[model samples]
Target: MFARWVQEILRSPLLRPGIRSGHRTSGIFVPVVRGSSAAGKIALLERGIILSSVAYLAFETYKWKKGQTVVHASIKVDDIIEQADYLYGSGETAKLYELLSQYKDSNDAELLWRLARAARDMALVSTTPQDEKKRLIYESFDSAKKALELNELCWAAHKWYSICLSNVGDYEGIKTKIGNAYIVKEHLERAKELNPKDATTIHIIGVWCYMFADLPWYQVKIASALFGTPPSATFEEALEYFLQAEEVDPNFYSKNLLFLGKTYLKLKNKSLALDWLTKAKDFPARTEEDIEAMVYVRYWYI
Candidate 1:
């Protein structure tokens, strides 16, 4: 109730795509100090920040809980969706691709389903080994696209296809990956156009830029001279992209809080990160796969 009131008071109509109007991420809430008096307010703020800082931890909680749910899945396909989500959410590109490859012989009708799943997976992993993941990504994407072409479900493919392409940017070595960078970028841009209001698309773009802006821990010596100059909108742009995404798809990730919190830490901003992480910690949808994402987001600067 209070959160909604604050959102009503502060929401900017112009903010793109849309701001997530929720109570803020749980992991981020630790740093908050909400109270009646000045001291209480200060205390609240601090605690909220701490809570927010644990977005990664919160994400883990969600992942753990989610894994438990998947365990109870009644069927193979349901179990596959659960498993697929875990891999995709955690950013395990190589493993995700391998999973798709395993299902290569899926019967014709199931092909699109598996491909769509893989495309969604591609949107999460780093760009380095994308060459490694590409075959599966393409196969899956083509499968979905073909199905969509035959039917009218093509719209659904837009977001996942875009994601599959956009996420390849995070792989280890990208200078020589043929049909790699361009392929993903094309789909991503297309997604933005097809469904500019979608949260998944925004999240996809945000993750791509944030991960790239951070770069490898060891590459500073060689690329700092050029990449060091920093792209004016790279990180901030990603955040902008993601914020809009949240407005469109609040419940999409179940890990959105963790993503936002980690990105804030990258910017050396304290308050926002806390707000997000704290929210993540309290998620009822926790999954074990989310731990992978939490591990990546929870750490400082690395």
Candidate 2:
């Protein structure tokens, strides 16, 4: 029976490594950390014995009648955070809201916050060009503010609020909300200082830097000459950060080759720019239906 259990464990993929791949911990082992978990320890011991016996039975069943063998189901990405990757995009709200509304047994406030955010983004993208940007920013900011009303404490949603405020903060009275897009850097830094392991917070800091830093050296020099507050140009630095972000999660960004081509051109490397231009023409993120894409392809590339 013991040998059968070992054999069953050897045959089971779950017993080897999990979805994490490199850092896999077997679920069957229950570590005794301290004296606080009396019931837990007892339960662990009981489960260990039962599990081994079950494994033996499973192996025997596998040999005799495969239908009687027990198996553990694999966890899907959707199970952990429903449509989690879509959280980055503006189109995920309706589906998320429908799921949230149907989940009556849920007490998860974070889920509610995400649903609200998605709805707000939908409103932002659907508005007319004249009022769309500002209106969407306000709509999303208001949704995030409701997290507190929904009895939820969400620092992440608050961060999104700050992003929205920055995006549409060009008007006179509302300019104070985001004094400069650079303020987001400090906020994200604070979040990172508070939680060193928070990848999302770190990513946002990179984003803030990229947006503010890549505003064109000539334009910035001109602004500084006139406005007397020239922020140092860091396009190379911004590029580095964006590259890091892309490395962290390649699937998050829709193809953005056009920007890369333009960036290379801005740096005055026509050869590299032409190569990137060719690549950009094939990217799926070319939303603008202008000759700009092919023009670059022909002028510099051909």
Which ranges in model 1 have alpha carbons more than 4 Å from their true place? Answer: 1-114, 118-138, 141-153, 165-173, 177-179, 217-233, 291-302
CA deviation > 4 Å runs, candidate 2: 1-109, 126-136, 145-155, 170-178, 188-231, 284-302
- What TM-score does candidate 1 get on C-alpha atoms? 0.47
**In each prediction, how many residue pairs overlap at the backbone (N, C-alpha, C within less than 3 A)?**
70, 0
What are the Cα lDDT values of the candidates? Answer: 0.46, 0.41
For model 2, residues 1-302, the per-residue Cα lDDT tens digits are 54354335344565333111011110111100111122333454454344444333322222224533232333222342333223222223344433333322334545544544453444433223646545644655555555534542455554554444454454433234224444555544554565544434444555454444566566566656655774343556545544554454442322223444555666687787676567655433211111233334445555
Task: Kindly report the root-mean-square deviation of model 1 from the true structure over all alpha carbons.
Answer: 16.3
Provide the lowest-lDDT 10-residue window in model 1. 26-35
> After TM-score superposition, what is the CA distance of residue 127 in candidate 1 from its true location, in Å?
22
